[model samples]
Target: MIDLKALQNNFEAVSQKLKKKKIDAALLELLKEESLQLKEKRNLLEQLQADQNAKSKLFPIYKKEGKDIAELKSQLDQNKEKITAQQEVVRLLEEKLSEIALGVPNIPDDSVPEGSDEEDNIELKKVLDTPVFDFAPKEHWDLDSNQEWIDFERGVKLTKSRFSVLKNDAARLERALVNFMLDFNRSRGFDEVSVPFIANQDSLKGTGQLPKFEDDLFKIEGENLYLIPTAEVPVTNLFRDEILTADELPIKLTSYTACFRKEAGSAGRDTRGMIRQHQFGKVELVALAKPEESDQVFDDMLSCASDLLTALGLPHRLVMLCGGDLGFGAAKTVDIEVWLPGQNRYREISSVSNTRDFQARRAMIRYKDGKKNRLVHTLNGSSLAIGRTLIAVMENYQKRDGTIAIPEVLKKYMQ
Candidate 1:
């Protein structure tokens, strides 16, 4: 959730920043009106209670004087009814305000470029180089067709479309990628962790996946849990509702998980390959940092991810997401897109984001700062999407005869 107090205090400034994300100014106006109404209702309820208390205190004097005691009692009863009714109104108004707050996305950082979509995203730098193919490069599907590496039809038979089964070296490559990514990030000072694949509603909401993007989540039927869309949800929520010491401000963690998503709105995009899957493996990096340390921490995490790609000898580029492309909980984000030679384009393999207390406020993840407790800035990124990296490896390391050569960095793990 965004800082409601900030929105209330400076609606114009906050709304202006939100406009970069394409939020309507009219919605902000409506939220402002609702907030004010809630405040008014609360004030009225307090006044009613105060008046009732004052009238009750005078009851003893009226009873002692044996004069107008009945009138005083009637007035007290009337005040009680008014107070009760006002309290209900206040409760309803508060709920309305909360709903609005939950729907509102975080304000984009001032430095975020204004744009409407991925096409408008700004490319920062390219890492490595796009591989030059001696022959016509084939997409992952065609390459897999020349071998028995992937079973797309069986995937559809077993579950549905967008789910695949890896065989032989394909499966090995996926596992290798997961292990390599986890170890690579852990070596970079991130504490390795294994988290539950299923998270409760509160955990989902804490990570900004609920009430807005629930359509994209795979909810577990009959349970209050949902299959986590990303490791960020579970990793970041580890500190949910907890306050840590300032010394623990820069907590870094890495985890590998099989992420599940409904991909409800992403129809007809990347439908053929592992690029878009109902379930995919990923190694995620999450960090909790003090406000002062979040920026550097975010860059450090991004660098670590970039280094992982470099180590794998894969070509990729770093792109800063424009405001409209920012995730719901992110104030700023940088997407690491790996070059897919076969596809002749870059596909997002990782997205490092600095939520900057947006998630902390919702999750109640705070740090004790002397007399006050403050929200911790949270950051998360996919070190690499295992399936996409596999795609990159296959596409980039494909032999002319259709056999794939494993990258040198992954050879040790494969052996």
Candidate 2:
């Protein structure tokens, strides 16, 4: 959540920053108004409680002097009622404020470029070179004309559209990709972790996926649990509502999990292949660092992901996401797009983001620094999407005889 205290203390500054993310100015104003009202009501409630305590103390003096105490009792009773009413008012205002605050997106960093959408994103640089195929490249789904590797029809029969079953080489490739990515991330100082595929409402909310993107989630029936859209939700939330010592300033972890999404917002996009599947495998990187060192950690994460692609000999490019294209909880984001020979263009295969203290505040993750407790900066990135990487390998390594060659790095894992 955006800091309400910061918003209240410097409304104009926060307001300007949020504007870049296309936030409604009027919403910020409403938040400020509710905060002020809550403060006023709390003050009134405190005064009433103080008055009640002072008046109740007078009872002893009244009894000692043998004076009538009925009027004093009546005044105290009325004051108690007023206090109760004021408390309720304060509670409601606080609830309203919290509702508004949780729905607001994080303020974009000053370095983020101004843009309306992905079209305006700035490309940092390209890696390697796009492969030149002597034969015209075919999309993943069309490469295997007999559909031996990926079974699409059965997937629809078992579940629904946008779900596919990998078979033979494709299945092995997917597993190998996950293993390779995890081992690669571990070598870069990220400890490997195994997290649950299911997450509860609180976990999702802590990662900024709830109260706004519910439609895009696959919730379990008759329960508050939902299938995780990404490992980031469960991995980053491991430290939720916890405090860490300063010595553990940076916590880096990598995890591989099956991810599910409803694709509610993506109606007509990438409907033909596994590019936008309902279920897929992903290897994720999550980190928590002191605020002062988060930027360097962010750069490290970006390079880690980019270098992973380069190791596979896949051509890709790094793009800086503009304010409007940034994720809901990210202050800044850099996306890695991998080249697909069939599509003749680069598609996003990974995104590394630094949320700064945004998720920490929502998750209540803090670290002690000398004599003070402060929110730790949180970051997450996809080392690579398993399905997409397999697709990239297939298209880039396809031969004239309609056969796919495995990359040298993943060959050992495939065996």
Candidate 3:
């Protein structure tokens, strides 16, 4: 959620910043008007209460003087009725204000590039080098030839399309990647956490995934819980509605979880292979930092993920996401795309984001600074999406004889 007080105080500045995200001006105007109306209604209610109090006091004077009290009683009753009506009005306005405010996306940082989509995103730098192949490289699905590594057909029989079962080496490789990524993150000062794969609506909303993107989630048939789309949701929400001491400002955590998504809007994209799946394994990095040091923490997180890819001998690049490409709650984002020789292109394997108090405000996660409670900046990233990394490994390490070699770093884990 955005800072409503900031919006109310600096409407023009807030409006200008939000415009980069393509927010309609009318929406902000409606929010402002609703906020103003709510304030006025609240003031009116206060006045009504004050009038009732003043009139109620007069009843005692009338009784002491032995004067007529019927008219005084009637006025008090009428005022009480008006107060009830005014209270209802205030309640409705508050609801409307909350609905509009909760739907607003985070304000883009001033450093974010202005663009409309991923194509407009700026590339920072490329890491390692794109592998040179002696022969035509084959896509992951076709490279296995006998379907011994990945069983796409049987997956559909059990579930549906966009589902696949990793078999033999592929299964072991997936598990190895998870363990290696977790260990790598832990070595970098992040505490390891085990979080539930299912999250409640409040948890989702805190991370800017609910109400707006609920369609992309797989909800329980008759419950408030939904299969988590990423470990970020549950891990970040761990501090929800809590306040920590300033000494605990930068709380870094890494988690591994099975993620599920409905992929509702993606009707016909990445339908084959593990690029997009209903269920996938991921090693996630989440951090909560003080406002003054969030930028440094963001850099550390970016390096942590990018370095992981480099260690695996995977060629990748860091690209800054433009305003349009930024996630709902992120003020800024960087996507790490790994080289896939078979696809003959780099595919996104991780995305690091600094939400900068966006999730904190929604979750009420604050840190005590002196006598004040201040929101903490939240950051989340994938050290690497395990399935996508596996695809990259298969395509990059395949020999001419159709055998796949594990990355040198993952070799120990494979044992």
| All models, RMSD in angstroms | 2.5, 1.9, 2.4
lDDT of 2 by residue, 1-415 (tens): 9988899999999999998799999999999999888888899999999999999999999999999999999999999999999988999988998899999999899999999899989999999999987889998888976779989898999999999989998999889889899999999999999999999999999999998999999999999999999999999899999999999879999999999999998999999988999999999999999999999999999999999999999999999999899999999999999999999999999999999899999999999999999999999999999989988998888988889988999999988
Residue 176 miss distance in model 1 (angstroms): 1.3
Task: Score candidate 1 by lDDT.
Answer: 0.92
The regions of model 3 sitting more than 4 angstroms off are 49-76
Supply the TM-score for candidate 1: 0.94
lDDT of each: 0.92, 0.93, 0.93
lDDT of 1 by residue, 83-155 (tens): 9999999999989888888988988998899999998999999999899889999999999884488898899
The parts of candidate 2 lying over 4 Å away from their true place are 53-73
Ten-residue region with minimum lDDT total, candidate 2: 139-148
lDDT of 3 by residue, 309-374 (tens): 999999999999999888899999999999999888889999999999889999999999999999
Identify the leading candidate in terms of lDDT.
2
Backbone N/Cα/C clashes per model: 0, 0, 0
